[model samples]
Target: MSAANSPDFPMFVSVAEARQMLAALLPALETEWVGVGQGYGRTLAQPLAALVSHPSATESALDGIACRAADTLGASASAPAHLQLTGESRAGVPFAGEVGPGQCIRIYTGAPMPAGADAIAPVEQLIDDGPDAVLVQRPASPADVRPEGGDFRAGEEVMPAGLRLTAPRLALAAALGHARLPVRRRLRVALLSTGDEVIEPGQPLLPGQVYDSNRIGLSAMLEECGCEVLPLGHAADSPGALQAAIDSIGGADLLLTSGGVSMGKYDFMRDLLIVQGRVSFWKVRMRPGGPALLGGWNGLPVFGLPGNPVSSLVVFHVIVRPALTGQPVQTLRLRAGTAFRGLPDKVAFWRANIVGGEVHDYGKQGSGVLRSLSEAGALVVVPEGGSVAAGDEVDVVLL
Candidate 1:
């Protein structure tokens, strides 16, 4: 058989082509330093380091008397020796004078320890505490005191660039005295749906018509990827309508459309691209979403997806998402519990559910079956000319 007639035909492009296509399309936007509390899901633009030494200075970790550990080593509860209290120290305050021998400073938690003090004797372990002197109830150790820079060092790198500032990470940055964080600009994506037979959800569906779902679904997924979605709404199934919608989204970095790309009579998306932009490729050797479209419009990337709900979703995840995020495509292999009688020349993606570690294939694996796509946890990827027995291993692409 010729290459085209082979059961496992390959349509491959160089990895460099894929990477360059992504880079040429997704140019990084200007960075902004947003408040740390509002920086969730944003990629960090610069590394964050501690502004000052943690603890800032020597401090006490407990409400106690600051004293030299050696002086209190032999003092016991039963027969305690007295030490004069020079003064009291609270949080954010430092003892004004140094502690001398036979003298201690009253210190609270987080207070800077007075000079000449090596440890803290907790309040419960002290007796007859007055401003002048106090008696020891139990001996204390050096471990009771928290020294300067105990938790973190000065000028230490806390979080590096490219970090997605989550809630806890923001709090940590705030604790390190970072009021604002530099983060990558959000990606702007334009969403459009095309079809005369499709109507918006909640609108009355006439005979031979269905609700338009791709726009809502794709917008949600794009937002989850941190993209600022500019929804251009639905475009009618006509060359003029498609061109008008494309023109309206001229400012977007990426343009994503559902439907009107297949080799059908009313496939205006391809014709619109031929007229307005460079059409790189019209189709891929994949099932469900084989009739995919990749092109550029006014120097921006445009992906024309199949109108069928499952096909649109599959192509979006497997091809479009990775292309937009500049990430590598991942694949997996597993057992195909569903029987395949014969293998075809094209790779197929079947809706499947994993039950008890076994893949159970769903019936009616049609491109328009949005219900099946919603129910499926993964797509069983059957390579060209591949077949599977009940317990045989198969490749799967997790949705």
Candidate 2:
């Protein structure tokens, strides 16, 4: 008999236990090289090192004049030092001549420092007495100029492998002269929904029928995690139908099926997994989507999510999404906008939004209500048997 169907295994495991069990089984996706411009949201597979030193030469940081620090010494607002303006240095246009004693070079932002100049004085700090000469009232510090390799040196490791490329990170790669970056290939996840009552959207609805909302919702969630979704559509709640649906997804790295995992008479996923595959865990002791199943089928990892739209998304954010992105979801603590009371046995994920740093839950916390997930920007996690009174601190997971 399979472990899921055996009497020894718990019918429901804690969320932590379920995640820990699956983490050991899920394999890492392969890597590929992609254009750096298109790498946002993708995880890097190789460490990126600097190709050339930034600010290859010492340059000016201000749009003013470059001169010897000694030239401006001992000058004050009342007694100013005057220096002859020899030449000017515009950005990308270097002055061919060097500065000599009692001379300064007019320079703009990012302009290379002249051969003899070691400091820059801002235009506001000096009086421009025509183009021939300038007056500086105070001494310029050597720190006024950016030194060579001020940002990074050649061959220095700037970005490490496994980092999810964000806008700023991509810019860093571009600045390092990498036209392409090595990134992990997107995970392929198959999506399927089970239940006779579930009908396709735009189809005529019968008395007991509802649109297949999970397919679209789950697809979006999987896509957001950079997974290539192989949507297998819907299947009836039956042994044969479930098997056929599973067979349709040929090469998915992960299979995600919504509904049919609970103990209802029509819920066939839990029982079928026990008979045809190896179920890592049958249920998770969490609210809004507690009837979750994780398993392996024909060597492919499978996630059986609850049928309710909101529940599926919550569980995805807490579990599946993190596994795909290879990053832990972000969480914060904020003041509760209202009191929350729940059962002592199950942890609750309350749909919520942060307004002025306060956590406010949605009007309806039901699993089937997609509106709750739509209007919420975060999930307020209420620990088992925990009560959060108004104005109390509660932990939140950002969506």
The number of the candidate with the highest lDDT is 2
lDDT of 2 by residue, 1-399 (tens): 434446644567887777666666667778799998889888899999999888877898998889999999987889888999999998789999989999998999888999999988888888988879999988876887999899998999999998988899999999888999999988888999999999999989999888998898889888778788998988998989999989877878889999988778778887788778877777787897888988878888888999888888888889777777778768898999987766688888888878988988676888878887777888888888888888999989987
Q: What is the lDDT of candidate 2?
A: 0.85
The lDDT of each candidate is 0.77, 0.85
Candidate 1 TM-score versus the reference: 0.67
> What are the C-alpha RMSDs, in order, of all predicted structures?
6.7, 3.0
* CA displacement after TM-score superposition, residue 1 of candidate 2 (Å): 9.2
lDDT digits (tens) for residues 1-399 of candidate 1: 122232232233232343355446677777987888888777788898888777878888899899887778778888786888888889866889998888898899999888888888999889875658899776766887787777677699988886666778887788788888888888899999999998988987789998888888999989766788998999898888888888877568888889988777788886777666766666676777877766788887887788988889887777776766555556677777777433366667788888777777887788888999888888877667776678888777777
TM-score of candidate 2 to 2 decimals: 0.88
